[model samples]
Target chain A: MPQIFRRSANSYARLSLLGALLLAGGLIGLIMAIGSSSYVTRANEFIEQPIQFSHLHHVGDDGIDCRYCHTSVESSPFAGIPPTKTCMNCHSQIWATAPFLEPVRSSFRDDRPLRWIRVHDLPDFVYFNHSIHVKKGMGCETCHGRIDEMPLVLQQNSLQMQWCLECHRAPEQFVRPRSEVFTMGYRPAVPQSVLGPQLVKEYGIQSLTSCSTCHR
Target chain B: MRPNQNSQFRNSQLPRGLGRWSFGRWECAAILLCVLAAGCRQDMHDAPRYDPLEASPFFRDGRSARSLVTNTVARGGLREDDHLYQGKVDGQLTDTFPMPVTAELLARGRERFNVFCAPCHGRTGQGNGMVVQRGFRAPPSYHEQRLRNAPAGYFFDVMTNGFGAMSDYAAQVPVADRWAISAYIRALQLSQRATVDDVPVDRRPELDQAPEVRLPPGRPETPPAPEAR
Candidate 1:
């Protein structure tokens, strides 16, 4: 017998081939979308920490400086997380028995550390130093956003490689007076375009784009 | 033919009459492979390593962090100057500063004191810091006759060794910074007790006018209580 399905056979195969190619392309697109989604990138995601520490209440209303808790920001690579002792220094008197601060109390009592979940986490390969940035006149708000406004801390920036590279290429655009580095609501006295280069020269800031600056 | 054999032959071939399972084995496998590939990840986050302070079987002491070798100073950390490092000269607290008391030193001192000492000793050294307001014990005011007469070395010693109820600031503050803070305390004392004659004639006119700039951590310019009565 002659091939029963002559013309339609190859047409069906071609359609199937087209469908397979489309499916592969769609899968790749989906993967890319997922990788950059809020679920994966965690931008604007509020991580549940051990204690409900409100930057709004403490830094905003109470007018506490960021340096009070993150004491090592000026001197070390890590903006040192406040230990139980720092909390107890104040909490030992105020709100010493509040239900909300139970974890802080227990951590202090047992001399154990509260396992705060990492927010703004980059991959292990990438390195970031808070001290160098702060010393170079970048405000806490520049990278951390308006932390004073957040009741629950969230990852404000995407913290992606491109986001980092944008600032690294022209650090003058972000540089402030060294005095204003800790001021959350600081505004440049002059326009950023005028002030940035001036401050960069004054501070002798070098714009670095080397891979080892962060990736090593 | 046996029923099993008949069913097996039909299953191997494509549907003679169109029904749901028309795809071949290779087609089914391709679908499965796509599903599996979508779920694939490298598992980098779960890579084997010891976390900080983690217990380890490899170590006899069961600590991942090894203790530093005995009696060692870190590189470039040899603190040598008697006055700069110990706030002392000739094994006694010296009244004089090792470095010159410059205008820049006072500026730096003001910044450091505000961050470190002003929490307890108030911005103006009035012994009424925010911590004191919140119930921490108030320290002696710098303007007090006793503290006013205190040599710069006295303040440095108190900061380095700590006074009653105050813990040593040796960890929080560097040795040179302690001297800066002491010098700032002297300036604060002078400010509280300054005579009108202390203002230089050329610059005195600016003092009469309300301060245009907010001076850091000192007396706020009070508008001369508009012609009292």
Candidate 2:
């Protein structure tokens, strides 16, 4: 036969096989890169809310307690969003006419709620209760990172199943005294290893690994 | 062969680029099947049900919350204890707690008070809370004569039914919690007015260590003679 082909068919076949292997490897790396991207985890992303309320100003500088805003944390499954009346309790006097606080003012005047966008939204399947965790001596800072330091709130933790299971498996590592549950800058008075076990017993927490604890 | 016969022979054969350019019929069918399969399976996310508090257009009221017919209470919803639920006996506010006040109850009271009352009432119940500083109507200090002598039920009554500018905490605070907060408020009142004699003899020595009294900033300190140190 005349030399119609560029090279032997065998050589072409080997080159194609190498290209196929390289392509498969590249595809897998791309998938992993996407899986670990910020879009998936939402880490360090500033979530916009109706008000530009700075935690740095309220919680850090002014020394207002977290409970002042998140009122139902210790009593209910949901951490209650403060009604406009709560904001007006202060803003009706201080910052009464600041343009930035107009939304808050309007909401108070109209009796309509300022619909704040939720930052740490868990999926419906996960049954997380703020009260139970708070009562059992978990600090607000444990799941929500240094919130007082943030200008605009962001979801700091991944809040994935694997992340949840880490704490659930070893709750002693995270548990504090009930008195210190609301203390944002809480540290163990004794070392955590020595104190954690005693707290777990004191709080009557059963470190549950059951799927139904969260899934149901 | 004639030129027309040659052209006919080439046309009848398969196109030369078929092997390199196109997928087989089976491969195209498989891709189409996969695309259709992906489109069909979204049942979990789009399940047929109303979310909690979702508005219903079918109802005339446009509310998902259906009111109880006339007066229907759910199981375990019957609140029969007058002392526990109403904080009263016959018609007057009772002076006693329905349940025994334990250390645990006091702790719960402290937590609940900090969250609900401390914004307006101050953590120490001094009526100098953040809201008061920012100029809401300042509530009277719990340490004042009027509140200090008020019965425990009086505090509960105020919380249960709002007094003056304050709104009722009945919705925010459960009945048992109202009692607990009342107990805590009493403790706070006593804390401010407590005398040195009120301290236990064994603990009295600890209080004898005079706390360092630093003068306010910008005031000149009058130094005692060098020997007074």
Best by TM-score: 1
What does candidate 1's lDDT look like per residue over A1-216, in tens digits? 345468889999999999999999999999888877777778998878878889987777666677767777898877767767677766766677889999999988875667776776666566778888888889888888999999999988878787898898999889888888887766665567889999889888888889999877
> In candidate 2 chain A, what residue range of length 10 has the lowest lDDT sum?
A182-191
Model 2, B95-170: lDDT tens digits are 8888898988888789778877887799999888876776678999999998888878888988888888787777
Docking class of 1: incorrect
Chain A vs. native, model 2, TM-score: 0.85
Task: Provide the lDDT at A145 for model 2.
Answer: 84
- What TM-score would candidate 2 get against the native? 0.73
Off by over 4 Å in 2: A1-19, A53-58, A61-72, A82-114, A190-194, A197-213, B1-86, B209-229
User: Per-residue error at A80 for model 1, in Å?
Assistant: 1.7
Give the distance in Å from residue B16's predicted Cα in candidate 2 to where it truly belongs. Answer: 22
